[model samples]
Target chain A: NAGVTQTPKFRILKIGQSMTLQCTQDMNHNYMYWYRQDPGMGLKLIYYSVGAGITDKGEVPNGYNVSRSTTEDFPLRLELAAPSQTSVYFCASSYRAGGPDTQYFGPGTRLTVL
Target chain B: DQQVKQNSPSLSVQEGRISILNCDYTNSMFDYFLWYKKYPAEGPTFLISISSIKDKNEDGRFTVFLNKSAKHLSLHIVPSQPGDSAVYFCAATRVFDMRFGAGTRLTVKP
Candidate 1:
């Protein structure tokens, strides 16, 4: 299985611009998450979905939005980009809730907001 | 506030030596702890994990020790190899909420 896959390995966006980071998983995981890692900082959860049509905010959800329309896809949207949004974003999935042991991560997408 | 923290930013060890990475969490809600290894240009991969119930968990050359009282955990790699050089992240999770540490770069010199 491909496990988890994220699109746009690298991207640069101007201030006030918008873009979507696409994520897909072939593992049919019930839980999916979006996290961003800044330089010298740990991964901060932007959003998470326990299943399709159920999304919730996380530690750093400002300027970010997410939609889980299908079991395989969980996309993150940035309405208005800002310099503070520059970071490496990662998508991950797990077979079930509370089972991080089965978590699989995507390569990551590096975003630069200028 | 940073819930999970890896105090050491980097660590260097000679090949075949033992490399230990430490992590501490400020939240007591974290029951499951994990260690992930990340190579350059790649995503982090699961290395090992320990639950709060068990004090330790071992998998091959990797071992995880958890101290619930101190809200601390550690990963020990024995006989480290050059290929083992990478950034190690400590993660703690409760149910669906997971937090990661800043990461500690481990360099295994040959």
Candidate 2:
């Protein structure tokens, strides 16, 4: 089974442009997350959802938005992309919270904003 | 402010040697800690983890140690192999949030 799948493995956008990064999981997980990794930095949380229809902002959610319309998909939206938004984006999911549930991550999407 | 920190930016070790990576956190409320390894062009993969109540947990060749009083944790890889080369991330869980520290690059040379 495809654990977690992300589309458009790489994308380049111009300033002020908008795009969506798609992520889906077949694990039937209840928790989903979006993170961005900058060079030499840890992955920073952009947004997360506990389940479908519920979402919350994470540490670095300024330029991003997310929606969990269904349990299997959580897509990240970038509106008016900025240079600061150029980074490797990762989508992860877990069955539940706390202790070794193992958040399965997708291959990642590399986005560049000029 | 960064709640979690991985001080070493990079480390190199000969194959078959022991490789130790350290992580420190400023928050004492973290109940769970984890180590994830990431290959180039790939997302971080879960390696090992430990809980506040346990000082140590081992899985295969990887071991994670937690020192609650010091707010410190470590991942030790015994008989490190060339395949272990990657960027390693340390993460901590607090309530409903999870925080990740700057990663450490580990290279095992043959």
Candidate 3:
């Protein structure tokens, strides 16, 4: 299983430009999440989905949007990139809810908003 | 407000010594705690985890101790090796909401 996979390992975006970060998992996980980690900062949740066609905002979802079109895909959308959006974005998935079940993370996408 | 925090930004330890990383959380709702290890260009990987009912969990050379009363948890790596040198993140979750600490960079010097 590939676990979780994120596309475009790295990218540079100008202010106001929009892009989508793609994520897909073959584990058939019921939960998927998008988190951004700034230098020296912990991962902040931007969005999460419990299943197909269901999405929810997280703590840092202000400039982000997410759509879960299939059980294996959850993509994050940046409507208009900002300098603050520059960070390492990770896509993670978990088999089930609750503690003890570890979340598998993808390699991460490093984005720079210039 | 940061619900989960790793006070120490970095820690240095002699090779073959013990390295302990600490984490604290303010939310009592967190029922599960986890530790993740990450290298320079890679995503974080799950190292270990502990449930609320258990006070401690051990996985090979790594052990996790949880203090529910203090809302604190710790990860101890015995006989630390250079391979263990990386950023360690402490994470907590309640059902679906998983929160992470700022992370502690552990340097195991040879």
Taking the candidates in order, what DockQ does each have?
0.74, 0.73, 0.86
Which portions of model 3 miss their true places by more than 4 Å? none
| Candidate 1, A3-74: lDDT as tens digits | 899999999999999999999999878889999999999888899999999999989999998998899999
lDDT of 3 by residue, B1-110 (tens): 99999999999999999999999999998889999999999899999999988999998999999999999999999989999999999999997688899999999999
Off by over 4 Å in 2: none
Tens-digit lDDT track for model 2 on B30-54?
8899899999878888988888899
Clashing pairs in 2: none
- Give model 3 RMSD, 1 decimal: 1.0
Task: Sort candidate 3 into its docking category.
Answer: high
Instruction: Give per-residue CA lDDT, model 2, range A1-114, as digits (tens).
Output: 989999989999999999999999999999999999988788888999999999999899998889899999999999899999999999999988767667899999999999
Where is model 1 more than 4 Å wrong at Cα? none
Error of 2 at B85 (Å): 1.0
- TM-score for chain B of each model, two decimals: 0.98, 0.97, 0.98
Lowest summed-lDDT stretch of 10 residues in model 3 chain A? A94-103
Docking class of 2: medium
For model 1, the local distance difference test gives 0.92
